[model samples]
Target: MAARIDEEITFRKLEILLAFLEAGSLARAADALGVSAVSVHRALHSLETGTRCSLFRLEGRNLQPNDAAHALADVAREVLQTMAQGIRSTREIAGYAADRIRIGSLYSLTSGTVPALIMALRLRKPDIQTELVLGSNSELLRKLRDGELDATIMGQPEGTPDIESQLLFEDEIFFAAPAGSPYAAQSAIDLAQCSDERFVSLNEGYVTHDRFRDAFRVAGFEPNVVMTTNDIFSLMNLVGGSIGCTLLPGRIRSVLPRSVCLVPLLPAFQMRQKISVSFLRTRERDPNLLSLLAACRSHAAERPLASG
Candidate 1:
């Protein structure tokens, strides 16, 4: 005989069985559990198979549960409640029941703004533990909205309602070119002048990519495209290799290769990316979140280099 407790008798199946028992019909159970009627039937069938016993009897067009089914449903309900309580107790012990801050940030800020803000936050709250999530601007904003992250450091997200943001700093955009390129020797270059030059850029969904495209719009022409990459480092390497020129934030100059030059764009064509610390409005009163926001404000007031 198969074991009574086997992998087939999963927690999900148990939940389904309990729902089926309470609702008295597969269709009703499916509605209660937000699943298809067929899925409810399948889980009940699997449960009966795993237990190696008859759980239901087909009475005309309907399924009527036997004594065994009722007994198992009682046990399953108790088991689910116990498991839920165990999870809550574990979270309490792990300090997650309190205000544990989870901060999200741009991947590019990991080596710079993120570390500085973290260090400053720790200084203020030595006992506080933090979780840092890194992603693109859009991903971070979504996570923040879903409560997965308490706050995020990124370029200010536009058209997102119900988020509160504090401006951290403005980073100027520059035209990056090969060191030996003729344009590198000039103190500044016009974006229109590079209209015909092949360019390397970040793919869509990145804030920088949108900014790069907008710069071309200001210059009144489309950019000659060659390659698109995910990270700024790769884009910089492409420029260093003389493959193409690209636009990048001025702060990135601290890490650029000597073979790459970051030339300023003329004032008329200059673009600036505004970095901000953002959080859901609902989390505004959270002490840990407030502390983190204070740290960000302090860091920005110091006017530190974007390279950290």
Candidate 2:
């Protein structure tokens, strides 16, 4: 009868060996593995004992793998890759794969590009169902980061590390006032003229709310906010009544009633918005996510989006 082998090989041992080979020293290998040097020493000892062969020789500060250890690298890598694939497959079966995508966007996109994109998606893949969430930039990004939203079309979020983005459009921000107002008659008005003037602005956390605030600051002034509201319609109502002037996007020109006029900012300060599609890069390849991405790209290409 053949002698039964009692040695047990493990993935951890393989990882340690690989780390050592690449780092060329126990201290460096430990750092790469996020462990201490003493832990690395123990792992190497375990691996050496299991194989019943000398794998490494310490010379100066370097740990050099001998021939027997060097020869096992290819096999170790193949095993690790196989294990990773298995884990990925398990995650897919658990509904972590692209089975569904939850989309979020700014309210403005809902009226035009977003609706067209949704219809186009349904036409392309009738069986795919999507959940659309509407909110301002800050809320959408919060949901996106919290994993409550799969993707969102909002102004570019600053300092988001794990999020990925693709730019779709750039639009100028304009000053909007009721039609026939002296401010409306001018092609452009200095931002400072309104420094002490009453204004209507979006509720806190809205993307444009911040943009308008920043513009005021840049112009060396602060706005006299007469009112703040979440609904754009309400803001429009206030502007129409001449209650206050508010910042608006140029795209709304054709849509807004004749009672509203969009004028350029003095010295022409623009928010230069870039409507983008954003999602976690790790989630990009999910099938449902892939579908959503395709829809956004197609819609962007077909629409008359603002350029540059």
Candidate 3:
């Protein structure tokens, strides 16, 4: 037979035991835990009974803590502290709101949108700690679905009906090129005219990369991408160095290098990216998610999605 687990020993009793030992009297112990003296007395009595060992001695009219009681009190403090740490660790792993709130975002938003929203979140939840995970739209959506993230701010993903999202803004994709490129002088450039242009693009999962493919497909030809990178920043740097042309979101305009120019795509090739804060539909009522939604709504109010 399996050994019987001790059910009598519990956190409440241990807490009372610690208080009773340190406070020197039942009344003081009760006051420490905001309970009545009788409750403290009963809890200590139960704890001693549960230990199955002599932890107190009857001295005339009062019970005095024995050496064992003192030692057990130390253990009790350690147990409480260790349990507290364990709880925090579990919550962090689950990305639940305990000590930290984990947020996911697309690399494109890092320049401005993500930063502004984080500041807004801090104002509403000053005590809550934040952890940010940046990745592509596909990657962030996967993480959010898998419970690894508390919320995500990105170009709203497609076909993910399970996610609850708050629309923050909409952004248009722009054709990017070297600042000195002749395309900079045009009011709009047809992708067909740049069919021979060498391009540097972000990897497959990025919203920008996916949108690039869609836009090129609409233009009725495949882009001659000379290079592909996992990040948007490097792709932009390549554009700045004239390595090749690329596509970028309008939101990225604030951080684009002076050596690069973002030009409008002709009507046929234009794709609007709807940026949003997404979380599990079930987690809509979570305090952290609610705060995040409020922050996004506030951001949307101050900076509406650009009109094409």
lDDT on C-alpha atoms for all candidate structures: 0.84, 0.78, 0.87
- Winning model by TM-score: 3
Instruction: Residues 97-145, candidate 3: write the lDDT tens digits.
Output: 6656899998878878888998999999998888899998888888888
Model 3 regions more than 4 Å off: 1-93
Better of 2 and 3 by TM-score: 3
Which pairs in model 2 have colliding backbones? Answer: none
lDDT per residue (tens digit) for residues 152-243 in model 1: 99899888679989888888888899999998899999888776798989888677888899899999998988999877888889999998
lDDT of 2 by residue, 1-308 (tens): 99764365689888988888889788999999999999888888887887788887888866678898887777888999999899888764433554455789887667676777777767766776678898888889888878888788888777888888877677778888889888877978788777767899998877788888878887787788989988676777789888999997765565676788888886646665778888987876766666667887887786656742
Q: What is the lDDT of residue 171 in candidate 3?
A: 90
lDDT of 3 at 287: 77
Instruction: Report model 2's TM-score to 2 decimal places.
Output: 0.67
